[model samples]
Target chain A: MAIIEVNGISKSFGSTQAVRNVSFDVSRGRIFGLLGPNGAGKTTAIRIINHIIIPDSGSVTINGIEAGPLTQRMIGYMPEERGLYKKMKVGEQLIYLARLKGMDYEDAKKATKYWLDRFEAAGWYNKTVGELSKGMSQKVQFIATIAHDPDIYIFDEPFSGLDPINSEMLKEIVLELKDRDKTILFSTHRMEQVEQMCDDICLFNNGRAVLKGDLREIKRSFGKNTINLEFQGNAGFLDELENVRINNRSTNFAEIRVLNGESMQGILKTAMEHTEIYKFERIEPSLTEIFISTVGEDNINPKELG
Target chain B: MNLRQILLVAKREYLTKVRTKAFILATVLIPLGMIAFIGVGVAFAVWESDSEHRIGIVDETGRIFPRLQSVNEQRYVDVSAASPDSLRQMVVGEHIDGYVTLGEKNISSNANPEFVYGGSGGLGLQTSIRSDLREAIREERLQRAGVSEEVKNIYDSQIGLDTRKLTAEGEETEDDTGFLTIIGVVMGVIIFISLFGYGGLLTRSVIEEKTNRIIEVIASSVKPVELLLGKMAGVGALGITQLAIWILAFMGLSAAAAPVAGLLMQDQLADASRLSDQTDEAVSNFDPAVLEIPSIDPLLIVYFVIFFILGYLIYSSLFAAIGAAVDSETDTQQFMAPIMVPIMIAYFIMLRAMESPDGSIAVIGSLIPFFSPIVMITRIAISEVPFWQIGTSLVLMTATFAGTIWLSAKIYSVGILSYGKSAGFRELLKWIRER
Candidate 1:
């Protein structure tokens, strides 16, 4: 069942349309990724889902109920613009935020401690957030966001400031939450993270969703029967294939892009005829390549709808 | 929001603030500082009173020297004889506080005698010496007239006049000192309640949310109004706690200081004792009526508590809203000035009420919700304010408080999450309209 469903959610800030007809859904237990470069309205859409902002049009439903304060409690949101009371102790801040989510004092404390321990941040319980390193503070904030054990979680750039080790730890935690059947939607510019972590993806560009689907499906659909070939004696491909483009060539390797209707076997035969092919394999598109092609190199510029 | 949730928010605000080292310091230091300041002030008053002034006695005819000696022994003045040049030299040398250089003419001549000192002469010393000289000259002239010493004493002695007033109920009363003392206490209480009670809450609440940034989190969770009121109530409870502590502390300090203050007041009371004794034998024999001043009125206490809470809620809500609206402590300066203006204006009107409780300005200001908290207390202290007026003012103040909370909450709802942008009147107005 879809835990969160957004339809045609549009918002504008003054003359700028921050989000236009933005729509997405998060089914139970899914890790949904909202992917975009900066200023692509992902943050605006997340805000609209979290009810931090009112959309200029459209509606959202949480757990089949219209959005309101009760639904707000069901969702845990970590905003992109990092906000934490710098002078407050990590434990105190977490418990306070937990209580706001309707946890009793003891339950809030228990949950706070549990999350703090899980994040290896129990040592930072008494330390003011201001004194913590950026990575440590991010860990504390991550704990705060999920401490209430909400059914739905929205994290915007949750891994932005973390070191590699901490980022891995966060990914594991996010996966753990997903395993527990918590619907999660997170926005990030890092497509590689989405490729590794997200089950479903929605890519936004210039205030609109440019590409979106199950991560595997989106990557699969972008594949053009391409073959990456590594060979020793290839001077040129002799322009022999009916429909093939040499996307890139190196000293001993060539990436051949075949037309949609062509087969990879044809490309492999062509490569074999042209040079001593050392390695030839059909390739699926990487999320990075697909994201670049769909969103365009300059994601900030508005795209003409085709 | 429910009361429990509001209190949850408030509790967070209060605990975060009160546990802060700065809040603890302010709470403890302010009262101690006030007591120390008053102690220093009293000590200075006593030291100034005790220091004897040196007066140069010219005594051109040598007739006033005996009187000067007798009066100087009373410890008010130290007298010395000097040549005119020596007197000027002594004044310049700072050997004396000041000197009264009597000329050959009667000391009470048209030209007021000049008192000289190293810098500016002390006015108290000059007045004391001049009065003593005049008394001495009068006695000498009276003796020269050949009146018997006993008769002259009778003629020189002052006849005291007793004063009495009847209230509207026809009860007799002593001089208006009792009323004036009540006025003083009222003014003190007004200042105490406004500054420490209400304004202190404002400062502490600002510091708390600033520390916790629960403000930011809550700004996202609930409307700014809920967060702000919750903060105000939470810190207001802390303020009330601190107020209770202070009231007890003050009672303790005053109880401790009273005997000492009494001892210091003994001289003035003794002088009064002497004058009272010289009246009719029955009057003199009677025990000094223990001043029979009315105690603080229970109704006034009730009014004080009610108005304090309401007034505090009004201003504190505004303060919290302002705190959320601004980004930093320095930015608060621009906003705080406007908030403080009403408080200050209320205080000045309270002062005016003290001088003339029934005056047009005092009455009008007291009827206004903003000024009523302080001014109504002043009125209740001195004269009997009509119950209907108190009721009307309270109703008006409560209504105003509710309206202010609603408006501030509108601003707070929008303003708390808003950062980097300096929220202006237009933005606040926009928020209100959005609401």
Candidate 2:
């Protein structure tokens, strides 16, 4: 079921068109990702869905209800530029936000306690946000977003400022939310995070969704001609490869995309000669390649496409 | 339109502010400051009056000197035995405040006596000495002219005018316009402080939220109008709380001191009754109530609160919008002038209203919404304000407040989310016009 259906919504700030003719659907019990580079209208689209910024045209519906304050209450939104009142105590701030989302005082307090304890931040309840470390406040903000237990959750760049440990913790919680059949939507340019989490995605380029669909199907549709090579040697031989394009290359790993009519086995053979291959496999193009190819292609030929 | 959300937001705003040190300081300090100001003035006056001056009279004409009595806290002593040089030395040595030499010409109409002194005496001391000398010279001249003491007493006596105010109902009451003006001035100052102090606080709070980037999170949960109103309600409630504390303190102080004031009134009345017994029995029929301080009309206080709330709502809404338009407190400077101009103008008009509450300017200003809160409250306190004018002013104020909130909410809704760009006048206008 389409829990959120955005129909060709457009928004502008002054003369800058922040979002243009953007349309997408987020399904129930699924993790949706809005993948785009900075200033590519991903944040703007998320805000529009949250009804923080009304679209200049078209409409958005959540569970058949038009996107507004009513629909807003059903969603837990952690904005890209998220923060808590620096002088407010962690517990009170969370409860305040929960109450604003329609929770009564008792319920808000209970939920706040549960979430703070879950994040292992029960001691931070009495501490002001200003006194908390950056990671600590980020966790508080996360708790504030979900304390009301909204059915649909929207997180914009939720992993941006987090350290690796907290990032993993956030991922685990998000996956746990998904396991409970909550519709989750998050926007990020970090492809690995999207790859590990999102079941569906809409790739945005210059305020337009250039590609969108089920993650597995989208990856499959790109074909399995790419070679994922992991080795232990200087990657200097990657520059000599013909009939292939190196999507990414590092000391021990390179994802080389095989051009049409090129064999992946031939590329693997070439790589094995220069370096010892611990692991090499033929696979479909990563989301990062598809993102770069789609958004990068649009960037290269701006006038023709824009 | 969610009442619960607005209440929740307002509750948070109120609690956060009320718990702050600044709020507690302001609430307690302002009344203490006013009391200190009045206490200082009274103490200075009492000290001035209590100061004593000692004078040495170098009288060449002994007849004129002996007739002079000690007056105006100045004491006279004979210094004729001392030489002119010694008298000067005495003054320099601080033996006396000053030495005044009276010659035979001092008794004449164009008398100019020489007074030698250190620079310690003020103009008040000199004026007192001159008046005392003139009185003695006049008495000497009158004695030489053979004028009787009875005639002199008649010549010195003066009459006083009794002031009364005739009401619209043709009843005369003791005039207390002076007291009323004091009330107006005090209330005007209170309103001024509350408007700017609380209004600025609201603006800074908005800027804080924007700077901290918490506004977007809150914005997603509530409508901008609701947020703005909740803040206004919260801050407004806080302001009222402070005002209530001050008013209660004043009332309590007055209640505690009323008996003492009444006792002082009775003392004055006793003096008047004694005078009346020596004069005519009809003079004793004077009403003692006329001498009593006029009590404040509770209705005026009610009007004050109403006007204050209306005024605060109107100004704070604009303050909130200004807060939203700018990213920081420093960026608010460009917008402050426009908002401040009206308040300043109203304050000036209120000053004029105190002098002549029924003047054409006062009447007009009191009816204009921007000026009415301060000006009309002053006018109402000073004299009888027509019910229609008060009714019209209240209506206009409410309507203006409603319109201001609507326009301000529009600017606020768009401005809070916008970042990086410091909003100019043109940008704010665009935001107000944006859908």
Candidate 3:
């Protein structure tokens, strides 16, 4: 069952149309990614879903109820710009945020304590946010978002400020919530995280959703014409390839997309003449390639469409 | 829309602000600072009044010299016997405070007496000396004109005006109009300061939430109207708490001051008798009622609180809206200028109300919502304000603030989420119009 159904929401600020006919849905017990570049209306769409902004057109329903204060309580949103009261203590700030979401004081405190312990940051409960390191405060902000234990969680650019280890930990927690049958929605430009974690996604380019649906199905529809090549030598012959679009190329690796009527074997032979190939495999296009191709095709048209 | 959400926000705002060291310091220091300021002023007045000046008079007009000596025997010395150089040396050596040399031309139609001093005293000292000389010269001129002692005594008698105020109840009482005017201005000033001081605090808190980026998180959970209302309630309560402390402190100090004021009055009477050389008459004739402290009407305090809340609400909502429109404190100056004008006008009108409580300016000022909180309170303190004016002012203020809050909420809801660009008046208007 779809927990969140955003139907054709449109929003504008003055002459600038921020989101136009953007529509998507997230099913229960799933990780949904809103993949987009910067300034691509992802934040605006998320805000509409959270009921922080009233869309110029369309409606959002959460569990058969229209999005509003009632549905707002069902969601936990961590915005791209994370903030806590700099002078407020970690525990008090979290509890305050939880209480704002309709949690009782005792429950909020208990939840705060549980989350602090879960993050192994119990010692930082009394410390003010200003006194914490960037990574530490980011953890506190994450805790604040989840401490209320809402059924739906939304994170925007959640891993931007986290170190690799912390990012891994955050990913694990997000997946853990998914295992518990909680619906999660997050927006980011990073495709690898989306590819690894998302069961569904809506790719945004210029405030329009160009591609969306089940992540696996979307990837499968892109076909197996793309090849992942790993080699050791001069990769100079990649320049001589025709009818193939080279993407994400490094000194020892390349992802190649063969257009229609292009021979994958001919490209592999040319790569072999220039370097020794250690690995070669036919694969469906990555989210990165799909995003580039989709957005690239979108850029070809006039951008300011009504 | 949610009372619990508003209360939650209010609670956090109240606790966080009250916990800060700045709040504690401001609460305690302001009353202490005022007391210190008043104490210094009283001490200076007492010291200035008690001290007497010694003058060396070189009366080349021999007719006036003896008169000057007879008027105040201890203050004047006949330095006419000394040479000019010796007199200059005496003045330089501090033998005398300075000298007054009167020539024959000085006692004529327009006397230009040369009264030089070593600059040891303030303008008060100079004024006293000049008046004394004028009196002596007048007496000398009168004696020379063959006027009798009885007529001269009649000329010397000073007439005083005894003022009394008729109360609304039709009883005449000791006039305390001047005293009450001071009280009224003080009350107005307190309200003005609280409105500005606490209003700025509300604005700063809004800017903090917006700039620190916590506004989105909070706004998502609660409506912007709830957040603004909550902040105002929390910060307003804090202001009232601080004011309560100050009022209590004022009451305590005044209670302790009764005995101290009595002692000071006694000292003043003693000094007066010594200076006038009429010991029995000065002390016997001194009426304590002349210096009596009038009782304040408790109803005025009730009015004060009503006006204070009304004024605070009106200004704080505007302040909060300004905070939302700007990204930083530095950007607030542009918006602050417009809001500051009415507050300044109200303060100036309060001063005018002190002088003529029933003046047209006072009457109109008290009726306007922006000025009424200050101007009306001042008029109420100084004179009997009619029931209808008070009622009208209260009604207008309450109605005006309701409208202000509604308008502010519209602007606040959109302004909080907008980032990067500084807001202009056009932008603010658009936000207010955004649905």
Candidate 4:
């Protein structure tokens, strides 16, 4: 059963429609990725799900209940902007936040201690948050968010400020939480991370979801018919072949697009006559290529994509 | 939202503030400095007391010299013998403050003593010397006029008048109590103003936290109202603690300084007593009760505490609301000006009440909740205020406080999370309308 269902959710900031008819669902114990470039309404949708904001013309359900205070208790949200009291001690801050999520003092203390130790940040528990590095503070924030052990977790760019080693550790922790039957929704521009961790992906552009499905299915649907033939000698063999276009030709390789009627055997026989082929294979499209194609390259300005 | 959570937040705030070096210095050093200041003031007063003029006399006429010496040997001046040139040089060097050169003549036409002063003699010293000389000359003239000493004394006696006042309830008290009442009113005003002013500081501190985004994390585990109440309670506790410490320190310093003050006062009283002995007919006759210190009413102190807390809470909630509504401290100045205007007006009204406790302005201002906390205390100090007025003012103030809390809470809930823009009056109106 779907743990969270967002149907036709729409929200606008002033006259600009930030999220228009955005819809998606997360099943129990699965990792859902909301992928988009900057200002793509991913944060807006996440905010609506967290109930920090209300959708203008749609409904959201969590564990069969409509969004409200009780539903809020079941979700752990880490917002894009960092929110932590810089002057407060790390352990005290974490426990206080945990207690806010409905833990008693004793339970909050134990959980805070455990999480701090697990993150190898036990020594920093007594230090003020301002004294810690950005990555260290981020780790403390992560602990505070998850200390309540909510049923669902929403992380907005949780890995943005993390170092490679810490980011890997956080990814492992997120996967472990998913394994424990906790549904998670994470929004990011890192396509490679999504490919590795997300079971289902939703791609958004201009406040609308343009592509979404199982990761494997979406990749499969893009197909694998294009081929690259690297040849030592290929001056003018492409003119003799029927229904084949040499997309590009270099000194030792030619990228060919074969028409539907053209056979692979015919292409191979033609290539054999022309030159000794160093490499010949069909290529699957990368996520970067698929995102660029589906979302359209016009809006995908390189500077804003990151 | 629970009481415990509110207390936890309050405790954190209070502890953080108390542990800071600023709080420690303010709490400890201010009272000590006040004592040192008072000590310096008293020392100056004492030094001024001794430096007043002392006149030396060198009289060739025995009759005039004896009389002049008797008059000059009082508290303000000392009389002794010296030649005219020696006296002049002593006056110039300030060895003698001033001197008199007596002419050799008794009831003669051309024989008046010459007086001289050292440097720029002040008005007080000049006045003293002139009065003494005039009195001596007048007596000599009276003796020459064939009036006997008894008749002269009788003609020169001063008559004293006593006063009594009747209250609205037909009760009579001495008019001297009016001055005592004024002192009491002044004390009450001091307490009332200090509490309200410092309590506003507490509220502003809370608002600073919200504006700085520190309150978001705090409120995540606590309710907004709890946070508000806890801060008020915590800061109130700190204020009370600081006040108690100040009062205790003041009392201790006063007790330690009282002996020296008493010694100086005793010396002044003794000099007055000696002068009174010499001029028994000159001193005015009045009842000792007119000069007695008035006793403090415990009930008045109790009323001060009650009004202080109520007034502080009322103003503080407004301050806190203003703090939350604005995004930054600089934006708060515009709102603060309007809020403080009423408080300033109220304080001045209270001052006016000190002069005329039963004036129309005082009566109306005391009845208004905004000014009642201050003006009522002044009225209670000077004259007997009707119990019903106090009751009515309390009820009105309580109602106003309740209303303020509800309204501020509405603004607080919306404003606490808002950022980026300066929340203007129009936006506030919109927030209220939306709520």
Candidate 5:
């Protein structure tokens, strides 16, 4: 069953329409990746789901209840521009945030300690956030978001400030939550994390969802025409190839996407004559390719939308 | 809005703010600094006002020397034989406060010869010396003019105005209007300072939350109005706490001040007339209590608190709104100018209120919402205002602030999320008008 149903929700700031007819749902025990390029209304949709900004039309519901203070309490929301009181100690700040979500003081403290320990940040609990390193503070902010143990978690670009190791740790925690049957929604431009972790995905471009489905189903529908090629010689022949869109071209590497009615073997025959073909194979499209193709093909510049 | 959420927000605000170094310093420093200063000042005053000193006379001519030294032997300051150089040495050595030098007699000159002295607070010495010398010269001159002592007394009698004020109840108070103005102005200034001091704190706080993105996170969990009220109440409670500390400190100091005052003034206060510039012989004949500190009504203070809360609510909401509307503290200056005008006008009205507490201008000013917080307090201080007028002022100010809270919250909710560009007046009006 879907825990959150955001139906035909639209939002605008003044005359600028930020989100247009955006609709998506996240089933229970799943991590739904809110995929979008920059300024593509991902944050707006998340905010609407969390009820930070009232939508101009439609509605959002969590477990059949409309979005409001009660629904908000059921969701742990970490904004893109995350913040904590700089002068406040890590433990105190986390507990305060938890208490705001209706946790009792004792439970909040316990949850804060558990999360701090889980993140291996126990020694830094008494230190003020300003005294922490960037990655460490990011950990603290993440801990703050989930410390209350809400029914749903919404993170806007949770991995943006994290280092590779911290990002890996965050991905583990997100997936671990899904294993425990918690619904998770996170918005990001980084596609690799979503590809590894998301059970479902929605791609937003220019304030509208251009593609969305179950992760396996979306990939299955893309067919096997995409090629990841690694060669030992010149990539000059890639420019002359027909019915093939070269996504990236370098002397030793090329990522090629074949248009419909084009055969992969036709490109392999040409690549074989021009360069020593090291590796060429049909594969499913990556979340990155899907994002880029969908977003780029729409001729939608999110910068202009912003 | 849930009361628990509001209280939770308020609690955090109070705890965080009270922990700040600035808040602690301001709360402790202002009152302690004043009390310490006044305490040290009293001790210094006691030392400076110590008893009598002797003066030296340098008479180059032996003839004038005997006559100058011929004055009374017993006086606060007595003349002793010493030259100008010797007197300078004595003054430096603490042997004498100062010395006076008489020039060589002016032959054929009618004006008295110039004499110079180096000392402070020798006015009593100056008066007696001048009178004695002039009397001696006058006896010589009067003998020539055949003028009588009775004629001299007739010309010397100085008459001054004796003023009094009768209140509506036919009770009289000494017309020490200056004291009333001082008390009234002090009360008004205290309120004005706290109103802005704490109000500006709330504004800066809003800007801080917005800039840090803390407001956005919290805004999800609570209404903007609840957040604003929580901040205002929390900060207001802290302000009251600090004020209470000051009041207690002041009262404690006052209790200790009386005995210290007695010990310090032991030599001076015995002669009750020494409190005034009028001679003991002169004022001792009349009532000793010609000047008074003037009493203030206890209820006036209660009115001050009521008006203060109302004024603080209005200004702080504006400050908070400005904080939301702008990006930083630098942007607050232009917005603050409009807020400051009413306060400035109220201050001016306070000045005028002292002069005519019952005048049309003062009456109307006290009735207006903007000026009532400041001017009305002064009006209450200057006279016993009717209960109905105070009630009306209170109701009007309360209603005005209620409306201001609703309006400012609208601007605050919108401004908190906006950045980069500023919200102009048209934008602000739209925020107020927007659903």
Candidate 6:
């Protein structure tokens, strides 16, 4: 069953329509990725689901109830632009947020302690947020997001400021939550993480959902015409290829996409002539390529997608 | 609509703010500082009045020397013999406080007698010396004209007008308009300090939450109105706590000060009471109660609290709205001016109208809803005001309060979510017009 469902929701701020006829769903125990460039209605759609902003039209339902204060209690949301009181201590802030999420003081205290220790930050409980390092505060922010034990969780760009180790830690925790059968939805501009983490995705662009489906099916629908190449030679032949685009490029490797009616062998022939090919294989297109081909170059945010 | 959530928010706000070091320091220090200031002033006055002076005389005209001896201030000053040239040396050697030199010339000439003093004399000392010289001159002229001392003494007494005020009901008392003006000033100052202190706190608190972005998380769980109200209630309760502490401290200081005052000012107290007793006898129906700067009327205290709460609510809501509209404290200046002008107008009008509390300007000013919160309380303090006027003022203000909160909540709902450039009035108006 769909744990949450959104149907034809539209929202506008003044004359700017932030979300237009956006619809998607997250099923039980599945991870839903909301993929978009910046200002592509992803945050707006998430805010509508959290009931922070009222939609101009249509509806959102969480566990069969309409989106509102009740649904808000059942969902833990960490916004893309995260903020916590700089002067407030880690312990007080966590407990305050927990209490707002409907936990009693005693329960909030207990949960705060449990999460602080789990995050290996029990010693930081009394320290003011301002005193913490950026990553440490992000740790506190993530704890605040999940300490209340909500049935569903929504995180917008949760890994933006995190280091690789902490990002990996967040990924593990998110997967752990899925193991406990909690529905999760997150928005991000990072395509690799979405491929690794999301069971389903709703790709947004220009305030509309341009593509969406189960990750496996979406990738399967785009036939195999891309090459993941790792070679130990000059990449000069990359300029000679026709009807293909090179991405994720490095001196030793590149992700090459073959356009329609263009054979992967033809690109391999050009690449072999210029250098030694250590490894080359015809493979299904990555979500990044699918995203690029579907949304188009003009739609991708250079700041985020580049 | 969740009262539990609202109260939780209120409790958190109150505890965090009141626990700050600045709050504790301000609450205890301001009142103690005021009392000490008043104490220093009283001590200076007493010390000045008690010190005696020893003055030397160098009257070149022997005709005036003997007449100066019988001067009334001779009891307070020891008038001694001295040479005209040595007068400065006398004062410099500490043998005399000062000396008056009357050169051998006409009394009405360029060489009018000069009185020079040594030591740091108070500002009023010169006026005393000048008046004393003029009095002696008058006495000398009167005696030369052969006028009786008894007649001259009677003519010297300056009798002021005995004025009183009468109500329409024929009840009359001594005019105390000056007393009323003092009350109005005190009341205005209290209102101004309170609204600025507490209302500014509310604004800063809102902006802090907005800037912190915690407001978004909090708002998801509670309505914007609840958040706004929760903050106002919390800060207001904290203000009341601080006010209560100050009042208790003031009462304790006043109680302790009375005995110390009696010990330090025993002579002055006795003289003041004797004068009051004499004045009591002179008036036909004099009551001892009128002598009292009436103890703070409990009714006046009640009025003060009501007006303070109402005034704070109005301004605090307006400030909170501004806080939501702007991203920073500096940006609030544009919106802040509009609200401040009305408060300033109310205060100035309160001060100006205090000259005639029952005048048409005061009466109308107290009835205008925005001004009523400050002006009406002032009018009540001065003289007997009608029940109908207070009722009318409260009704008008209560309606305005409701309207202000409603409008402010609308703006707050939209403004808190809006980040970046400071909003224009048109944007705020659009927010207000939105559902």
Which has the greatest lDDT? 3
For DockQ, the strongest prediction is 3
Docking class of 3: high
Task: Give the per-residue lDDT of model 3 (tens digit) for A1-306.
Answer: 899999999999999889999888899999999987777899999999999999999999999999999999999999988788999999899999999998999999999999899889999989999999988988888887888889999999888878887789889889999999999999998777668899999999888999999989988898897999999999888888888888768999999988876999998888888899999999999887787778774473322211
| TM-scores of the candidates in the order shown | 0.77, 0.83, 0.88, 0.68, 0.80, 0.82
Model 6: per-residue Cα lDDT at residue B248: 83
Question: Between the candidate structures 1 and 6, which one is better when assessed by TM-score?
Answer: 6
Question: What lDDT tens digits, residue by residue, belong to model 5 across residues A1-306?
Answer: 789999999887778788999898899888899987788899989988988778889999999999988998899888888787888889988888888888999999999999888888899889999899888988888888888888899989888777998889888888888888899999998776568788899998879998998988888888776998999877789889887777656779888988876878888998899999889988888776776667675575533321
RMSD per model, one decimal: 6.5, 5.7, 4.8, 9.4, 7.9, 6.4
The candidates, ranked best first by lDDT, are 3, 2, 6, 5, 4, 1
Q: CA lDDT of B41 in candidate 6? A: 94
Compose the digit string of candidate 2's lDDT tens values, residues B1-435. Answer: 988888988999999999999899988888888889999999999998887778888788787767765443347888889998888888889988888888878776576887888977789889888888888877777877888999788766888877899978999987888898999888877887778888999999988888899999999899999999999999999999998988888777777676766667667767777877653453456454554557888999999999999999889999999999998899999998998998999999998988888999999999999888889999999999999999999999999999999989999999889877679999888988898
What TM-score does candidate 1 get on C-alpha atoms? 0.77
Candidate 5 all-Cα RMSD: 7.9
Give me the candidate number with maximum TM-score.
3
Clashing pairs in 6: none
**Alpha-carbon DockQ of candidate 1:** 0.37
* Winner by DockQ between candidate 5 and candidate 2: 2
lDDT digits (tens) for residues B313-408 of candidate 4: 777777777877876767777777876787788878878888888899998998898778778877886777889999999999999999888877
Clash statistics: count for each candidate? 1, 0, 0, 0, 0, 0
Task: List the candidate numbers ranked by TM-score, top first.
Answer: 3, 2, 6, 5, 1, 4
Of candidates 5 and 1, the better by TM-score: 5
Considering lDDT, which of the candidate structures 2 and 6 is the better prediction for this target? 2
- Model 3 chain B weakest 10-residue run by lDDT: B286-295
Determine the C-alpha RMSD for candidate 3 after optimal superposition of all C-alphas. Answer: 4.8
lDDT of 1 by residue, B363-413 (tens): 889889987877777776777678888989999999999988888877666
Task: Report the error of model 2 at residue B374, Å.
Answer: 0.8
10 residues in a row with least lDDT, candidate 4 chain B: B281-290
lDDT of 6 at B269: 52
Give each prediction's DockQ, rounded to 2 decimals.
0.37, 0.78, 0.82, 0.19, 0.59, 0.62
Q: How accurate is chain B of model 5, given as a TM-score from 0 to 1?
A: 0.67
